[model samples]
Target: MTTPHTVAPSERPHPWDRDAPHAHVDLDALRHNLALLRARTAPGVRLLAAVKADAYGHGLLPVARALAAAGAEAFGVATAAEALALRGAGVPGDVLAFGPVRAGIAELVAADVALTVAQPADLEAIAAAAAGARARVHVKVDTGMGRLGLAPAEARALIAAVDRSPLADLEGVWTHLASADEPDATEPDSATHRQVAAFAALLARLERDGLRPRWAHAANSAGTLLLPEVHHDLVRPGIALYGQPASAWLARRVPDLRPVMRVDAPVTFVKRVTAGTPISYGGTWCAPRDTVVATVRLGYADGYPRSLSSQAEAGHRGRRVPVVGRVCMDQLMLDLGPDGDAELGERVDLIGGGAPTAFELAADAGSFAYELLTRIGPRVVRRYPGT
Candidate 1:
């Protein structure tokens, strides 16, 4: 006799369950990418996955948890709040805030989050906030980024100051590469090479002076992929871990990385239009011939750039359809050809999967993958499959 079937409880609507645009984050792909990146580093060189900007808009906690399970040695974030959030989630691994902490210093110190001390004032503030507790810190040397790091000449003195602080633990030293993603980055005369040499010189000086920190890192994703010499003790990989090459040059060097995020939207409305009908705002694009216009529920507000209004294509059942007219704040129209078969409720690939990759889409929009990925707005639901 067949057993009685037990009905499962009705679950609440997930981000993907709603009839709207959603981002499908493939956790398996994320883990695979992490493994690939790990394989690129030396056996002893650790990897600090950069999860800043909500893991490049792929959801922070989910991405961090997945990476931790995949054996990430550490995580790099841009804010103290991000670091604290990781700790609150019980994520196992070191969480380093790449930016200097402006607030939540005591909380971060309590959470064991490693902070970046870029200046003397930053050190003073962190030491004061430590309250006699040992606060982990990584000193940031300008090296050439000219951003939030202390001058190379001043970095040595700061390291000494950190060592002298009873409440501070100098754990590492790192520098950001300004042009590591450039095409000629590996050239001896390139800015990336200069930065690497400068950082190495500083480390050498620190070693001679008995002031070298426990860890030294100066490689971003580009440097990790191309300049193995800069791998030093740890590598901070950001865009590469998200399955995006840091540059076109790096893409050619490493061609096996898989994209982790796929953005898709349901076709909310579809209509047959005449040749002269304008599809969206400003009457910018008039159909060249009788066609089927499908309205996708995605727009600039959802991180689909308005600049991609007339230049992008969406993938629908293996066919590339042109995006006609200006993309709206909440919707965009796709020209599905005169004999198009796209129906309402069907999903279209706006990015990744069968559509143009994020890199390609960013290029079409005159931007880069970093900006495109991080700009994915909150309105778009993020769903992680197989998490």
Candidate 2:
């Protein structure tokens, strides 16, 4: 006779259950950002939403679907797997793979994803892998980034090679800008100008060699905002799509841009500690006085950086609570001061509070919001309200 085992209800998910420490995505903000991009971009300039890095850790599948529904013409990802994931998520727009495309032709071809031909070898690989699949290809010209793509002179030769390959279809020609974010980040007083000029010269050479791509794009979010002239047939809007201004230039140019993501968590336990009592691991923080500490259910494992140990804060009841002690692997302690009204299970605003922006945390961590968002771990259940 086998005894039946009883499983605890806590171990099972309820029919309508949700976990704590979630990232709430504002769909209205997403739509508004898309509209802003549409209005700012030149007429007929396509907007390609960069949904790479899991849409900057905002849930790629939902964010991609939302952006597509909000009038995005295309989507860009870093890998073939990401593009394929979007296809699986029911994103019915053009997907461009910006990462390496060596032996993963089957995934791209199966998902009808476009490959970015950066090197001559990449073009050759796509040509060989595409076979009769009708592969749409974009040639990436390395103007100033020095990352990938063929050089200005080699672009013509690459275009010639692409023209000879029956497996790949050259649908577009594009390049990336190195320092469009900082107007002075480029040298010679015209580094941005030179890159675009080289891209244009490459295109002219390609045409001279009897190769004409259907589309030509070379603008990222920074390039799109800083130099509208770089907006060719399409513009890739990555951070901008999620409401984070792509650059400082864009912040000055478009102050109305709204960020779509907000990180929020619940106060798990709140207690008072005596003065001089150290908190958290390594005893890094001591209660300056009789202090009220709120233990929030978020930690470095949730993408909240441990470097924010002594610097970060969250909004609670119209006041700011400083994150105290070391940000542990699974939890963080916040000092609520001596006199505060926040209680157990109270909602605390983390990233998108009216007080601390994700930008602030990113700056505190010596990084960018792009990295912050992309690094958010999968533990945080992403909640999309506008979806």
The sequence of per-residue lDDT tens digits that candidate 1 reaches over residues 305-336 is: 99998899999999788888999999999999
TM-score of 2: 0.92
lDDT of 1: 0.87
Task: Report the C-alpha lDDT of model 2 over 284-365, residue by residue, as the tens digit.
Answer: 9999999888888889988899999878888888778899999988788889888865667777888885447776678888
How does each model score on TM-score? 0.95, 0.92
Q: Which residue pairs come into collision in candidate 1?
A: none
